[model samples]
Target: MSITRSQIADIAHLARLALSEQEIPVYAESLSRVLGLVEQLQRADTAGVTPIAHPLPGQRQRLRPDEVTETDQHELYQRNAPQVQAGLYLVPRVIE
Candidate 1:
């Protein structure tokens, strides 16, 4: 999992990044450490583990009651429009 200077250069080229000679070694070391961590995690045993949406199994999300709170104002709003048909506003076609 150890990243080399040439690998860092290739990665920088693909990512369209401009890395100085000093920065390349620093990035290579950082990326190597990250890959080492990934390799360590790959050795973990997750055979009996099940994927979960929430961390807490018994927790329930609180939601507001499904109810209409606003009165219908479409007719009032359409009164100011230049042209409307079948409850829809009509606009002039600008493109062929």
Candidate 2:
């Protein structure tokens, strides 16, 4: 998990970052500590653990009935439009 200065320089180049000579060693040390933490987490045991969609158990999401509750009001909405023809809104052409 020890990141070198050259590795930091390469990472900076790949990420399109401008890192000075002084900043390379600082980034290398920081990245090395992050990699060490990831390495420690990889050693943890996660066997026999069931993956859960929700954090709280026995909590089901309530859903409303899928049915039309309102009547058609197309003509009512079209009355507010400035220009509407053949049940479609008409707009001024912009592109040639």
Candidate 3:
């Protein structure tokens, strides 16, 4: 699974990257080395492995009770807005 200089050049062209003549060889060598590493990984033994979300099983996110702790100043929050209307921050229209 060896990558060629031409393959790297083609990839760079497709990605709209302007690689220099010297940089092309560097990129080709770099990509080849990376792919070689992946090939080695593919040869390794991973027979029975279950993909888990948090790496640790049965671990839930620590969360406190969703209760109102303190009241916030509505006027202070609105003071920073460029435009505030009817106690709400007014956003610019996106539609033409």
lDDT of each: 0.93, 0.92, 0.85
| Residue pairs in clash, model 1 | none
The root-mean-square deviation over C-alpha atoms between each candidate and the true structure, in angstroms, is: 11.5, 11.4, 8.0
User: Which has the higher TM-score value, candidate number 2 or candidate number 3?
Assistant: 2
Residues 1-96, model 2: lDDT tens digits: 999999998999999999999999999999999999899867778798787988999999999899999998889999999999998899998687
Q: Which regions of candidate 3 deviate over 4 angstroms?
A: 44-96
Model 3, 15-40: lDDT tens digits are 99998899988888888888887887
List ranges where model 2 is wrong by over 4 Å.
Answer: 45-96
Prediction 2 global C-alpha lDDT: 0.92
Candidate 2 lands at a TM-score of 0.46
Local distance difference test, candidate 3: 0.85
Worst ten in a row by lDDT for model 3: 49-58
Q: Residue 33 of model 2: what lDDT?
A: 96
lDDT of 1 by residue, 1-96 (tens): 899999999999999999999999999999999998889877789899887998898899899889998899999999999999999999888697
Please give each candidate's TM-score.
0.45, 0.46, 0.44
Superposed Cα deviation of residue 46, candidate 1 (Å)? 6.0
TM-score of 3: 0.44
